[model samples]
Target: MPDTKPALSKVSVMQDLLKVVAPYRWRIAAAVVLLISAKISTVLVPLLLKRIIDALSQPQTLKALPIYLLAGYALLRFSSTLFNELRDLVFSRVTQRTVANYAQMTFEHLHLLGARFHAKRRMGGLLPDIDRGTAGIAFLLGVGLFTLVPTLIEIALVLGIITSRYQAWYAGFIMLTFLVYTGFTVVFTARRTIHQRRVNRLDSSAKSRLADSLINYDTVKYFTNETVEAQRFEEIMRHWTEAAVANQKALFTLHVGQSAIIACGVAAVMLQAGSDVMAGRMTVGDLVLINAYVLQVCLPLNALGFVYREARDAWVNAERLFDILHERPEMEESRGMPALSPGRGEVVFEHVSFSYEPSRPILRDVSFRIAPGATLAVVGGSGSGKSTLARLLLKLYAPAEGRILVDGQDIARVSATSVRSMIGVVPQDTVLFNDTIGYNIAYGRVGASQEETVGAAKAAHIHELITTLPGQYDTEVGERGVTLSGGERQRIAVARAVLKNPPILIFDEATSALDSASEHAIQQELNRLSHNRTVLMIAHRLSTVVDADEIIVLEQGRVIERGSHEELLGKHGAYARLWQLQQREDMDQRAAASRA
Candidate 1:
């Protein structure tokens, strides 16, 4: 099925725009006053020129030359320019503030959105929409407000003057020309919209492909598929090229048709005015005034046609961005929800059950507890719901059937930010921001001091390694910490968590990415960091959990064994079997190492 949504109504888009402009209403009002004054001066300039031309044509009027009229005409032209510039100067603030406000709102809302939404969305697609949306807001505020509104005002004044002073035929012909020009523009611009929309879609897709391909540059090089990736991108670009050409052709047709209508209207008005002058019913100045009005009114219509076309695409882009703002987070809390205040870091999963979908349950009636300042290890096979427990505790996903509590308070009643703020986590694959080593570590605590950051690094046993580097703590960790080895990145993750110093901590296979030597070395640091903290250890390497206070072996979302290492080993059940298997694997690894 094609993914299509109805575009927002024009009234809704305008209302949203007005809301952004609400704070700057006074400035906007002032700008409008200046705009009207400017147009008045502009319209009167043509009248003054007409008087000057008339005076020049008559020998008696030319003797004095009416110096005041010429001076007034020049002054009016200058005032028009001056008022227009002043209007822009006042209204530019509204445009800038409105765009900045919307952009910031969008930024905050994107972060408020759920993990599922972000996981499904492409960064490349959202970025261009955001950029275009802000640009659209600027255009709507600046050009749409100034150009479209002023043009309509000028046209109305011209039509009213003609209806009041000239023959009915002149007014009738101008109205008819306007209707024809407008109808042609509306119909042609609507057709052009189809091509513009296609161009926009292809442009977004091409950006997405470019970003995706570059992010996976290593994978592409490994598979030697650079040519294939380039070919795919070229295909998207080719489609965009064809759509752009079609859009330009439609624009040309629209402009040419509008110009023809205006020309016919101008010719009809001029011919009638000339006939009146020849009949001695009107002066030569009357003909000149009529011609000037036609040019003034019709010239702005050309700009109107262009603005109308561009505004359609801008409207579409802005609507798409506003759609993102409308997306409600999956786990948004109530407005007055209380923050989580953990006294002892006591975590309890009471009959907890969860699933991404109804039929695919990841955890079923699973329950566990960790006493204050105690360590509970969860050992499980892949897809056995170990990580889901950590995510649930983090409030990234809520349990479908039961409640999770911290310090006897149901987490559902507290804010997710507060819940997250009270706990620290180190996941299996640590993805660092492309920043300095010190910056990535300090991210764990928002306002940690430099000394505290270094202390955390030392606690994580990475300080010595960092000191050996050329830039030390200031060295740049390239995208996702690609410049650092897996062990180094994992250590940095540990340093971050250590810096946070949360009462509740979860090590979700924290050492899984490390080799035997690195794991053994970092294990000491992990042990030290877990001291006096309530910890949940989810691991596949059973050897690391041997000294854990309690071990729960999970399989298919069910806990099959729970006991200490020796006690579970004595049972000869799931824990024993896994332990024996890992024991043999470890021995084989050691034997292979010895031979090498």
Candidate 2:
């Protein structure tokens, strides 16, 4: 689960939205003009109806029909729809552009965030948050601007007509009805927002669970835990279903309450209008007018209620998105900082100290220097911080205590991107994109020609194997390159490094997971790759580091020994003990194979 930050307030969310919409303010103004025109036209429809009715009701009016008034009535209705359509057309660009801008910002921000941030987040949950947030922005902009504003304008126009042409009491009664209905809607929707948030949380949880299970599909199959995975997924879905039902119930209650209030208000207004007509205080046309106005006002009140509720939900969703934008990237790239100056890849780690958490230190006062084109290997057991050294050099993390100098420039003073561009890394596990082999190789250097790509592949000795495949270099590598054998994937990684041709390279346990034959083959390629490049090799097996220019033995975050393999073996210290143990294990394995 990713760390959850406090959500932005509704006002803050609106302010952010305003900034996104600022570029298209002229279009928004045009839409507003169209909106006002539409509402004015809509208000005139009832007025026209009242006039037509009064004309027909007159006894002498049978000979001269009110053709002009009838035509105007139809025109007003058509004009209202036309204006609304134009308003949407004018505003569509702003809405879509705003969504696109925010979506791209959030996407880029996620990439800018640190490794720790990603390590703590589940992609399944993060993706849904972004999707809902963008959608929420669109909904709020559309409904808040067009639906809510238009409804308010229509209400005001209808109320002004009622007050001017009829008794003050009628306007007062309608106003009171609106106030009560709005008050009820606000209170109920606020409570329902709680339910909506819960539903959203559970929905994210279910998605995260599904993604996690599927990502480890082979692990589950090997452990025969299909039932266990299914049961866990069902548990999350069961909670989601309950939350969804509760949300629906809240919606139903809100809608029914709104309808009941409108029904009572309409009934009372009609009853009073009927009484006034019977007493001859008001004509039939006036009675018809009040009825039409009341229905028109009340109907949009229902829509207003819906739009208000949706706006609240949209605010909730948008807040989640804004939370991502609010997250400060761990390494803030300062403006005007120079990129790393190109040099002979001289790397120096000076008394570096670091800890992911304060209490659990991974490195302490570690110091080393690798001159250009020299290979330095750090050999250690599983928790010994060899990998952390590589990470520090790459600028994935900044050392808590000393500074790292690459080409005599403090990496902290230069662009992290530039530092990374100068180095090529072949991690222990090579996780490729789910793309064609050619595409994956081309990722090493953007815009590399086919000849260059093939040359690099051939240099890594994987080109012949790739050519034998049915689709050749175009063959699709499944998710994370799982379709390829470990050796094949390692070769692809080497190919990528070869294509990059960086001045410095880091091989972090590159052959640690392979069988003896595969390890021997890949080791040769790795040695070839290391030629004429500054190399940092982090290895678990002592045998692999014998040929390194210098071998450092790490034990619990400290360098226990440093020497050439011959010097360390002559000394008969920790390095010698590890070498003898590995040699015995290798001989035993060979003997067992011979016996078999």
Candidate 3:
């Protein structure tokens, strides 16, 4: 197991965040400068007001009130607003670009992770985490940086001015008040985090259940379990509703506690200022200035309290995403590994062994070789490890006991991307992206020209059907090609593999979903596509592999018989038994269909 670190500190999180902003350093520097300038302008406005008030209180000087001071006060206020807006304008690009970059990096990293990780994690749950993480990043960049940092600077400036210019009592009261307010916010916000995290988890669970149920809607309808699904979904929502309420209550405690602290601080300052003014020791301008400073300081503290609370949750969400990025892939790219070198398309598996879980071995000491420009078919019953061989050859899972080689290179030593580039597969289950028919086929070979796409479709016997659709080649294949028939979808998958035109091809039960007529048509196309290429065909139906150059019957991860179509049948072993069984099933199916 990988080592886990203790909870991360806010400062540590912030330091890590700097790496993301490093590319946009100059813009960030500009934003920081603007922030300081804006705060300086804001601080000076109250001081200008002090001067204006003192001038007005003196009857003799009122007639000669300085217009420049009055005008400068207005300009400073406007400049504060202008500088803040300009700061946001500069920083928006940094925040947006950083979010996009991190999102893209996460996407690529997920693809790099092992298939095991995807199998264990639900797609619905994973997607919401990603969305929340990006949103957290945005909050930190825009609100936390802009609001929290500037609020601190403004507070420090206010405290410094009060201590130097006013009586010690004024500064002391403000400091004590600030410390009390901060202490309360820190303690109560910490308490709120528990509720916030619960809310996040509940929300994620609800979304996960909803998405899973929707994805399996057909199964639910077939089983008539709509009410059961609805009740299960309601259970998740009930938990979420309770969590939200608890979160709100915690928020109420934090805000009310903070308000009480601010009230005490403001009342103390006002009482002291009133006494100083009545005793003729201070001017009315001093009283007004103190009042203005109190409001300025405390209001931001309120906003800062809320921001700090929200930022903690944001940090938690972002950390979850970062954790996923940190996961190690099952297969690592060897440093300086060269790409696969092209040859005669020979594949060799030497004493390969593998298991999805250690307790249940899927393939044991499996050895096989396909000569260059040859077709080798593997036949077996369900769970006999036939498909596992294809997965091992594709390098989806590394062997536990042996190695696989492609074109004389140990596949484990070469880059997987390079290995897959030379091979094409038509999976047992055909799933197309919700896109145009042409786009799905062209996905096999990115940058394939329009002519090449249409040619491959025509070769697969799908071009004529596509042309008849209202949108022709541009017709949208609804999600997972639900709009297309089983045969139509398989034909599209065939077209994709054909367009790839790789040196090796794998058809894993490629025609299992088709009718007899469609199967005959598709089988002919598959044969033509397999010509002059190394092919590994895996099928449960014995008839599919009867014409292969060589055949191997695997039973419980062991090859029990090997020969040509007639040679295996002559033995009357596992291969012959399977053929006889399938032949009888075919006859029965034909009789049943005719009767119906």
Candidate 4:
């Protein structure tokens, strides 16, 4: 589980971030050198001012000094600006690449994970972690590399210069006072402030969830739980507001304390420099020099605060980023799986026992076989393991015990991709992405052209529908095929399967959602498409599969009866009961339509 605690300080977080920047070590080295040059220029202005003052004290060296110093100062500022821009350019590339790599790596890991992992994971929880990880990259670049480390360098150089030229007293006064101010503020305020930070993350997550909810408002309205959902969202927002305010209060206190310390430090440094000037040891320009040094030191010091804030957040993100980069996919490909011979479409389920849970078996001693170029329909009520059998066959879920054979070869031994390509699936859910109708149809076979796509659509009886749309085959399906009716989507799925032209076809309720007229049309397509192909199918409606070569009735994960429709009714088992029920329902529907 990811820690929900708001990263309170950057001091600890930044140490490890420096390691990730190791790959582009040379670029970072160049960036560091430029930063050092910039800092040296920044620190030198005070020394130049001191020299200008010393020269002015002697009438002999006065004339040339002012012009020389002014020119040098202008040159230093220009160089600093150039170096600063270069440093930023280098840093931006490094950050961009790191963030892109991390996001892609994480996305890949999430997708590779099994269905079980996603089933328990909340979309909100996973999404925020990704956002937090990406957002942390900005913080790492700004604080970890740029602000924090540069501040340390600035403080070390400033104190060294001040003590060597003047007295240890000057460096001591500045460092001691700065430390005291920082220490007191952090001790009193950090606990409350960090709590607020966590609150803000959750609040941000809540807003993302709310936006998703609004986009899915149609589903919310259809379920008629608008008031219940509104209240739930409102409650989340309220929690977020409380946490946001707490964070604000903590930051406000820290800033107010920091500002007061800055004022005191400025006054004290000036007072000391003023006394030196009055004593004839320092001149007006020397005072200017000391003031410049004080200001330079303070800039890095304030930057340290910003560094601490951002670094805290970045470290949390690093943990998430690393988690993804290090993940290994389960079920590694076997070393010696030979290429499968052209499939004869003969499948055998040999006493295959499988379950999602250790305690409960979804399929127990289930055994069946379909001969080459044969059609077999499996009929079962909900939770009777019909779909689990299909999944086991597809190698989506491997059987716990026993084995399945394809074309006289163990399925586990053959290449999973090769096995899958030999069998095309028109699944229960006809999923279509937001793409053109032509592309969606052509997805079954790569590089399929307009002619091929339309041919498949014509076979599925959807070619007329495609031509009626504004863009014809170019029309977008919208999200999950929402632009078309369920029957239309089903036809498109069937069309894709037809295009695949696999040796074996598995239709899991392919025509279940279609109206009678649409189903009748697609039924002809299925018959034509299934010719010379081994068809293993599952269907809810009896009328569609009544003509199958064999109909197997499954109950409680066991095949209780197997025969043709007439033969099953004569046997008067589970298949007979299902057949009678469906017949009664069809008769009632026809009778009601006639009366109306």
Clashing pairs in 4: 10-312
Q: Each candidate: how many clashes?
A: 0, 0, 0, 1
TM-score versus the correct structure, for each prediction: 0.96, 0.97, 0.97, 0.88
Q: Which runs of model 2 end up more than 4 angstroms from their true locations?
A: 1-9
lDDT of candidate 2? Answer: 0.91
Q: Model 4: residues >4 Å from true position, as ranges?
A: 1-23, 53-61, 121-128, 177-197, 204-216, 261-268, 317-342, 413-415, 564-566
Model 3 scores what on Cα lDDT?
0.89
| lDDT values, one for every candidate | 0.89, 0.91, 0.89, 0.78
Report the lDDT tens digits of candidate 2 across residue range 1-596.
23232233556667888998998999999999999999999999988998888888886857777789999999999999999999999999999999999999999999899878988999888889999999999998986769888999999999999999999878887888899999999999999999999998998898899999999999999999999999999999999999999999999999999999999999989999999999999989999899999999999988999899999999788778988998988878888889999999999999989888899998888889999999999998888899999888888888999999998999999988999999999889999999999988888999999999999889888999999999999999999999899999998899999999999999999999999998988899999999999999999888888899999888888888998999999999998999999999999999999999
What shift in Å separates residue 350 of candidate 4 from its native position after superposition?
Answer: 3.0
Per-candidate Cα RMSD to the true structure, in Å, reads 2.3, 2.4, 1.9, 3.9
Superposed Cα deviation of residue 67, candidate 2 (Å): 1.8
lDDT by residue for model 4 (1-596), tens: 34433343233334445665679888888888988888787777678767766677787856554887878877887887888888988777788876776677678778766556665555665676677777787667754677767777877888888888886667877897679766855564556546655775675568666766876878999999889878888888888888878777877777777777877887888898899989977778768877888888776676676566556546555555555544554444566777567868998989988778888778778788889999899999987788787787777767888999889888877766778888888877798989999999999898998899999999888999889989999999898888888888888888899899999899898888778887787778888888999999898887878888898888777887888888988998888888889999999999999999
Best by lDDT: 2
lDDT of 4: 0.78
Clash count for candidate 3 is: 0
